[model samples]
Target: MEPQLLHTVTGQVATVVIRHPAKRNAMTAAMWGSLPPLLETLAADPGVRVLVLTGEGGTFCAGADISTLRGSPLEAQRLAVAAEEALAAFPGPTLAAVRGHCVGGGAQLAAACDLRFAEEGARFGVTPAKLGIVYPSSATRRLVSLVGPATAKYLLFSGELIGTERALRTGLVDEVLPAGELNGRVAEFTGILASRSSLTQAAAKEFANGRTDRDAHWEERARESGDTSEGVAAFLERRTPRFS
Candidate 1:
């Protein structure tokens, strides 16, 4: 069967599932091409507050579909890079709920996400070295930012897969859960994110992702949003803050 990128929205959370189980959810060029527009559509929806990216079947993405590499390799790489950029640039919080193999381009997609929750058996690697290809500079920078230059170099240079424990220790994954607990934990966390103030989250996300300049309108926007006041009121009333 052909590879597919499937999406669904439930309340404030949107999920993008990589479905190519025959190749361990390996991403095809077409799947890469589809990502940016899919993310854009989700971003435009006011109801969607967070995105969850995962794979169907037992495993996460393996990498670029090697079959496509025999055709237009450069185009496949370009599309993959574009998709990675789109995920990295997503305005809202994004999480990767990973299991099994997440290697090469799959690792890139996970790195692009804000957080990653992985099953204990999950494996991660960056393997362009094995294929005699250059990993994109943006992806390299993002990987370095996540796990530092030395560790990033270790993975890129060796093309060796690491277990979930090493991934967590290296900061590649935020949390490690049992295979059965992964989805529930992710849903629980995203629910918390969705219930919080979007304005605050957006501002924090921007600043945390290396926005050095002060956003001049931040204070004004915050004040107008009334989130602080609502938060304070909620605290006093001992009720959940209703963020619009």
Candidate 2:
């Protein structure tokens, strides 16, 4: 059978599983190609309020599948870039529920998400140094945004996997649950996000991301938009905003 990128929706949450467990959920090129469309579909679907990215067989992604690189190195490189862009631009909140080794591209995947809830036994790293490679721009920007430029430089320079405790201290993970308790913690977290208003969540995320990069035009646009008024009214009425 073709390698699977398992996907399923439950209520307002959808999970995209990295399924190649025997290889520690290493993703092949074809699987990478399929992910952009899958993410696009999820982003467009009003029903999906949140997304959880996990792995099969107790492990998160190990990185790009090296075996597939032998066929077309250049194509593989381009595809990987596009995949990261797709992930970075995903509209809804995304949570990475990580365990085992989250290394190399695995680190990139988790970094792209809105939040990361890690297992107590989790490990994470960006291993470009070990592979004699350089990290890409989009990935670097995302990492730098989360942990600051100095920390981002240190982690990339070291290419060393860090334990869950250190990962949390560095702000790489939002929470570090006991190894066996990660799944339950992530379920609880996603359930909370799913129950919230999707429109408010999207706008709040956008505002947060753009907080540092202020634009007068954008501010004016938001001011002119009447959604905030309706949101305030809904709050007073204890009702959800009928966002247009």
Candidate 3:
């Protein structure tokens, strides 16, 4: 089958699946380029309260298809960075549901999400060193943020893969589950996220992503959103909050 990105929505969760199983879901140049626009479309949809990124079959993504780099490695790296940035900037909650190998560009994509949940056997690596390519500065900072300077340097400098236990311990992954339980857990978590107040989630995401100037802006949104009132009313009435 041709390598492609597949999109599907169930309830409020939108999923983007990377499909290139013959190469363990390695991204083609076109696949990398397609991601930003696809994310933009999903972000604009009011029905999309959450996004889940994963790979078809088991492997998340091996990296950019190495053959695509023959023309210009720099260009491929640029495309990957753009896609990663877009994912990081997504307005609502985003999660990466990972299994098998999530390395190189795959790790980049997963890192861009707000949360990552992996299966026990999943392996993660940031492998530019192996290819003798400089990893992007933004991606480097993000890695440091997630795993701290020591772990990020260990992965980037050595290009070695880490198992789920170390990954969760170092904060590279938020949760690690057994083989058959990953999908169910991701669904449960995302459903809870989808049911929360969007106003709160949006503001928290921006603040967590380092937008310090948005405090006043989010305060205004909260005042106008009616979610606060709805939440209090629901609490008093002993019912679920109907957050618009």
Candidate 4:
């Protein structure tokens, strides 16, 4: 199949699958360029509450297609940074459903997500060192925030792949599962996320992403959205909340 970003919405979850099986799902420059616009479309949909990014088959992503960099490596890096920032700024929760090799630009994309879940045999690396390309500063800061300065340095400096156990221990991934159970768990968790209050989730995401000035904004939203009242009523009445 031609390399592309395939997206579909089922209920409140939108899944974006990276397809480039011949190169272990390595992202082409065009694929990187397509992500921001595609994510913009998904973010605009009122029905979409969560997004799951994963690879087409066994590999999540190996990295960028090296051949694409031959013409202009800087331009390729620009596209990649744009795509990573777009994914990071997605309004609702975003999860990276990772398996197999998540390296280089693939690791960059996964790091941009709000959460990550890896299968048992998955491997992860940030490989700019291997390519003699300097990692973008924004991406580096984000990685530091997630896994701390030391661990981030280890990955960035060494360009060595780490196993699932090390990844989880260092806070790079939120969860790990056996080979076949990842899809089931991802579906079940995203369903729960979709069922919760969008207002609350939006507010929390803003705060967690380092936007400290949004307290008043979120307060106004809670007062106007009716979600708080619905939550209280649901608790008192012994039923699930129907958050709007």
TM per candidate comes to 0.97, 0.86, 0.99, 0.99
Question: 1-244, model 3: which lDDT tens digit per residue?
Answer: 9999999999999999999988999999999999999999999998999999999988899988999999999999999999999999999999999999999999999999999999999999999999899999999999999999999999999999999999999999999999999999999999999999989999999988898997888888888888999999999999999997
Q: What is the lDDT of residue 229 in candidate 1?
A: 94
Instruction: At residue 240, give the lDDT of candidate 4.
Output: 98
> In candidate 2, which residue pairs get closer than 3 Å at backbone N, Cα or C atoms, i.e. clash?
none
lDDT of 2 at 226: 65
Q: What is the C-alpha lDDT profile of model 1 across 83-127, one tens digit per residue?
A: 999998899999999999999999999999999999999999999
Q: Candidate 4 overall Cα lDDT vs. reference?
A: 0.96
List the candidate numbers ranked by lDDT, top first: 4, 3, 1, 2
Please report the TM-score between candidate 3 and the true structure: 0.99
Runs of candidate 2 with Cα error greater than 4 angstroms are: 211-244
> Residue-wise lDDT of candidate 2 within 108-209, one digit each (tens)?
889988899988888888887876766788889989988889888888999888898888888998999985888888888898887665556666677776
Question: Model 4: runs farther than 4 Å from truth?
Answer: none
Q: Model 2 reaches what TM-score against the true structure?
A: 0.86
lDDT of each: 0.94, 0.83, 0.96, 0.96
* Model 3 local distance difference test score: 0.96
